[model samples]
Target: MKIQEIREIIKLIDQSTLTEFSYESEGTKIKLKKYESSSIFTNGQQLDSSSVVEQPKVAEVKAALAPVVQQQKEVVTETVEVAEESKLHKIKSPMVGTFYQSSSPSEAAYVQVGSKVTGESIVCIVEAMKLFNEIEAEIDGEIVEILVKDGQLVEYGQPLFLVREN
Candidate 1:
């Protein structure tokens, strides 16, 4: 690439908060970093043709990397919920999947916060491997809170709902 194009690219990276960027074409490769003013550039040497065609989405890869960094310290998370002491218990996911409130797009939710439920009541569904597992309320209660949002990826044993027993 020409000098003006590279300046434009660097300006673009600097203007935006992109932490890193790279480009390669015609046997030349260049990498840029926004952490500091200086960027590491490797030139003249030819990059393997395979590297140019299969450019990975840096945003997606770095998006998942945040958790690893947080895990290295301790579990750091913003609290979206709280628990209350009562003759009640929380309904939890048994497996990992996207949690859904309704069976289909147009269907009413099986249960909601403030909804009364029985021991056998279908409170929610966990969609794992294309199969929707109906999650039942283990204890008869009135739902005090709904934990996970619809269509959110839920981990095994994650709190799905909190209920206050009747």
Candidate 2:
């Protein structure tokens, strides 16, 4: 199945009550399962939700996932910084694609730190599904920071650059 089709299936399953799903077609098999939040049971006895006793396994799981959560928080913090800078305007990706700083490998980047741009200036390119789209700087500004590296995969609405308006 195509990536878009799989994404759609996941969205559909997540919105529905089904916890498990499987599909197979033309030698391609896919399975999806959602975590069920149910009462924990031990020794054939259901534990009370308000029980003071703590589960060792649950504690271990939380400890193991702490670092992953911290990493996600760091990413969110970067986005928040962009939003919090009152004088900086963010150039965000218009689509989910691979970000390119220049038109090609041999060319210099379209814009760099301290570069001046007008509203019609092309700052970068975002390639999605084989189409290369030239992204323009909608506001006249000086590039203060490039938030994404060249050739990086970027999500829609992710900030690509921070600029100070002229």
Return the top candidate by lDDT: 2
Per-prediction CA RMSD (Å): 16.3, 15.8
**Candidate no. 2 TM-score:** 0.50
Best by TM-score: 2
Q: Which pairs of residues collide in model 1?
A: none
Residue 159 deviation, candidate 2, in Å? 0.3
- Alpha carbon lDDT of residue 120, candidate 2? 97
User: lDDT score, residue 135, model 2?
Assistant: 100
lDDT of 1 by residue, 32-116 (tens): 8855333333486555533332433546444534444454335223221221343359798999999999999799999987999
Query: Considering summed lDDT, which 10 consecutive residues are worst modelled in model 1?
Result: 75-84
Which digits, one per residue and each the tens of the lDDT, describe model 2 over residues 1-166? 5676667567656545567767664456779896645575778988655552432343453454355456567867887885668569999999999999999999999999999999999999999999999999999989999999999999999999998998
